[model samples]
Target chain A: MTYCVGIKLNAGLVFLSDSRTNAGVDHISTFRKMIVYERPGDRFMVLLTAGNLSIAQSVREILQTEQLKDPGGGEPVSIWNARSMFDATRVLGQAVRHVYERDAEALRHSGVEFNVSMIFGGQIRGEGMRLFSVYSAGNFIEATAETPFFQIGESKYGKPVLDRLVRPETSLDEAAKCALVSMDSTMKSNLSVGPPLDLAVYEVDRFASEKLVCIDMSNPYYRMVHSSWGQKLREAFDSVPDPVWQGATDLPLATESCQHKPLRKIGRPEERLI
Target chain B: MTYCVGIKLNAGLVFLSDSRTNAGVDHISTFRKMIVYERPGDRFMVLLTAGNLSIAQSVREILQTEQLKDPGGGEPVSIWNARSMFDATRVLGQAVRHVYERDAEALRHSGVEFNVSMIFGGQIRGEGMRLFSVYSAGNFIEATAETPFFQIGESKYGKPVLDRLVRPETSLDEAAKCALVSMDSTMKSNLSVGPPLDLAVYEVDRFASEKLVCIDMSNPYYRMVHSSWGQKLREAFDSVPDPVWQGATDLPLATESCQHKPLRKIGRPEERLI
Candidate 1:
């Protein structure tokens, strides 16, 4: 299992990925999942992957040197030379198809799905910024303004935070903070998603990024977020009013005069459930 | 899809279940997932089911009248007649097996797995309160001091709070509050789990519980929780500091002198990923 998130906000893009991987509980290992491709004055791209590690690794390796035929018989399109993020993502999709053709049949014989998914996003000199979620079938979907983020692998546990906090207009620094908080929530609940995170922040239209960093258990910012978020969350929970089961309050939990029908307990074997 | 949780703390037990049922996105209905069997001063049991609604409803119906034959020709053990919470759970397990026997094959023919799970807990007069997670195979596992809660269906999204807060000594009110917060988190992320929730809280050693209530979107307390939790969570998130990508803070996010090696951006097509 893995957890990786990529957000394309108005100000910038934020990418975060956990480094833990496991074939089973006893065989867990750490493998970083983010790779950056930068042509400082031309383009900057980041790839975050999850799913079968072998499949993902193969796709990533192939993508570095992979290219696609220019349907118009021009030069081959590769991530390094693509004019737009969409073309770069197509090169990635082609790489994934190449890996599928090479490994899918043998993997199927061993009962393994040829599965890998990726979040590929970046800014090319001529365009704004773009982000896509590429699937195992060599298909992809671009993120829209209304949905400015993409998450891959073990996504649900950390999703509520993103759903609530991430927005197209969020600032670069704040989006990075939200992504870390989201990752922290995920790591707390899931053992398979462990430490040693890879994070990169790219300012929109910059055509480059210098905010690539690795974080582990001792990273001060992360440690503070981890401890303080839990403490503050508990304090927030403590502030809520506990239900006064049968009593009156501003909000009656179960007042005798309430309009909605409450569930009636069955007092005998023959009683009907209402 | 569904979300139901049963928690046992020193003070008592808490059970909560969402009432939404959907065959797909287009076909959704409200079918309550909690059933309370209470014979005051004798026994109090709560059954929370998740998975196939039909299977769960069938098992609940069977459990009401289902009986297990006594090996020595004593009276059959039905949930109503069971002497211990454990015995009542066994009756529930037997009911699950009966349903599987009758419908698993037919369900499989339609490509539906015999998918169901449950959390059954309560007390009989002579023993302490017990909580269990029953499986599709009719097997079950009891919650203990180390792990005093069980959640079924769409559980991951809501699990972090329970992991952070619930303990053997947690107050019943706090646990109930925590359960509601957890449910709120699940509903925030998942469309399949929705409102019209059923909640029941039981006091330890009490043979019956009178706190079963149905909560809907209009329920004032739930409305408060929904808005307050979301607002407070956002406030809590804002309380944390944003990442200072390159410049120095007390906790340097990516200072030039940092010890860990940052991810290097590949500047050329021939560059190797390190």
Candidate 2:
């Protein structure tokens, strides 16, 4: 299991992924799920993956040299020489297809499915930044302003925060904070998603970023974000007034007759609910 | 899809459920998903349902008359005649199996799985309060002090708060507040679970409860829980400081060379990753 999120905000792109994987409760281990591809002053891209570890490892292993034949007579396009992020993602999709072709049959025989998903986003020298969610079928969808974020793997536990705080106008540093808070909630509820985490931020058009870092339990900023967020959240929850029932106070639940009809309680053995 | 939760606290039991049901996003409708059977001074039980609406509806339809043969050679036991909550749950399980026996094969022919889940909790004369999470196979597990709550259907989004707030010592009204907050989070993230919620609360040793009511968008108390929770959650998120990056602030992400080795970035086309 894994939890990875990539946010494409107007300021830049934010990528965060947990490093834990488990086959079952017994076989738990750490496996980094992020890769940085940067040709300084040219292109800066980050890839985050979730799903079968073997298939992800296979795709990463062969994706480096994997190439796609250009319809026209020209040099084969690879992630390295691709002129646009679109073509770069095509090379990645081809790499995923390559792994599927190589392993799907054998895996099917053993009762396993060939499943993998990825978030690939970055900028090419001549174009604006792009973010894509690549699927197990080698298909992909790009992020747009209306929906500026993509999260895969154990996403729901951490989703409410992302839905509330992230938007196209959110700053790079603020998006980073939202991503860490999202990851913190996920790790608190699910044991499968643990540390150390991999986080990277790319400013729009930089084609290079210095904000690639790893976070373990000991990082000071992360520790503050973790503890402070929990305490504040608890305080916020405690601040909301409890529901006051009928005869106790003046509120909706405080009256015997609410705006809506009350739920019927069967008080007799032979009462017909219909 | 639906979202339903039942919690057993020392003060008593709390139950909450959403009514929205959808076959597809286009085919959405409302159908109440809770049933309360209470005989004052004797017993009180509430049933909350989720999953394949057909199966749940069928289970509910037949459950009223369903009965289980007494292993001790006494009279047949139905929910009405059951002396213990455990025996009552067995009667409910048998009702589920009967529904499965009648519909599972045909449902499989139509490519639908025979799936349904339930949270049934209450008190019976001469016994303590009990709560059970009934599964598709008619099997069930009880809630204990350590794990004091059960959720069915779109559960993950609302789970973190329960993990943080629910305990055996929580008061009945506080548990009801927690349940509404949990439902509010689920509704914010998922359209499949929506308005007109049903909530019920019972006190220890009481066979009936007056805190049974329906809450729609117009209900003032629920409206307060809905709006206040969102505002406080946003405030809590903003209260946490952003991560301090290398050179900007002294933090985990603040140093170019972190305690953990930085993720290796590929800077050249021909760099060997292995």
Candidate 3:
């Protein structure tokens, strides 16, 4: 299992992924799930994956040299030479399909689904930054203003924070911070998503990134963020007033202010359960 | 989909459930998913349901008079006459099995799994309070001191808070508050789990509960909790320092104090993707 997040903001793209892989509780290992592709002033892209290790590894290996035929019939387009991010992602989808063609049938025979998902986001020289969520079927969907982020695997535990904080207007640094916080919550609740995290923060149109780091448990910044966020969250919870059961309290639980009827109780065996 | 949570504490037991039911996005309706069976001085029990609405509805209807054969060869035991909460839950499991026996095959023909899950918790006068998570197969597991609560349906979005805050020592009001906050988070992240929530709080050794409330969006107390919790959570998030990308800042994200190496980049197309 894994937890990986990719956020598309006005400033740039933020990618974060946990580095834990498990076949079962006993067969746990660390595997980096991020790939960075940069052509200096031409294109800068990052791919984050979650699912079967073998398939992801195969797709990553194939994607480097994988090419898609151009509809205009000029030349084969690879991630390196693609004119647009959309075409670059089409090459990635092809790589995924290539892996599936090789492995899906054998995996199905073993009763294992050929499951893999990826987050691919970057900018090409002539176009704006594009973010996509690619599926096990080699199909993909692009992110838009209404939905500015994509998360794959162990996503729900960390989703509330992303829902509350992320928007198209979020800054690059702020989105990175939010992504880390989301990862922190996920790691706290799910042991399968353990550390040494990979983080990449790209500034819009930079065509390169310098803010990439590997964060282990001992990292001072992650440690501080983990402890401070926990303590602060506890404080925030404590600050909320508890429901006052009865009497004239500050915030009464059983007030007539609600338009709905209070819950009905079944005090006898003959009463309706619903 | 639904969201229901039940917590057992030293002070009492707390149960909360939402009232939204959906077969598909177009087929949405409101249906209460909680049931209370209280015999005042003798026993008090709450049943919170999630999963297939028909299955839960059948279980509730059958549970009224459903009986389990006594292994000791006496009269059959029904929830009304069961001496222990364990025996009472066994009767509940039998009720689920009864429904399954009648409906599971037909439902499977329609490609709907006979899916249902329930959180049943309460006190029988002779022994201590008990909490059980009952599965679709009519088997159940009790809550322990380490895992003092159970949640069913759309659970992950709200689980981190429970993992952080719940313990055997948590008070009844605090647990109830926590349950509402948990439900609030679920509702915020998922539209399928919505308002008009049912909440019940029971005190230790008190066979009946006076603290039951139906909270809708218009409820003043719930309104305060919803707004205050959101505000405080944002403030807490703001209080945590953002990652220090570079320089000798107080919380540097890429500090040399950590033992792990920074992420390596692939600068050329020929570099290894692994």
Ordering by DockQ: 3, 1, 2
lDDT of 2 at B101: 95
Query: Residue B230 of candidate 1: its Cα lDDT?
Result: 84
The candidates' DockQ values read: 0.63, 0.59, 0.68
lDDT, candidate 1, at B55: 93
Q: State how far residue A47 of model 1 sits from its true place (Å).
A: 0.3
Question: Model 2, B1-274: lDDT tens per residue?
Answer: 8999999999999999999999999999988889999888889999999999888988877778888987789899989889998988998899999999999999999999999999999999999999999999999999999999999999999998888888899888788999999999899899999878999899999888877888888777888888888889888888887766746566656554445677899876677765
TM-score of 3: 0.96
Candidate 3 lDDT over residue span B120-194, tens digit each:
999999999999999999999999999999999999999988988889999988888899989999999999998
Identify the candidate with maximal DockQ: 3
Tell me how far the alpha carbon of residue A175 in candidate 3 is from the true structure, in angstroms, after superposition.
Answer: 2.2
Second chain TM-score, each model: 0.94, 0.94, 0.96
Docking model 2 quality class: medium
For candidate 3, give the docking quality class from DockQ: medium
Q: What fraction of the reference interface contacts is present in each model, in order?
A: 0.65, 0.64, 0.75
Displacement of the residue A157 alpha carbon in candidate 1, Å? 0.8
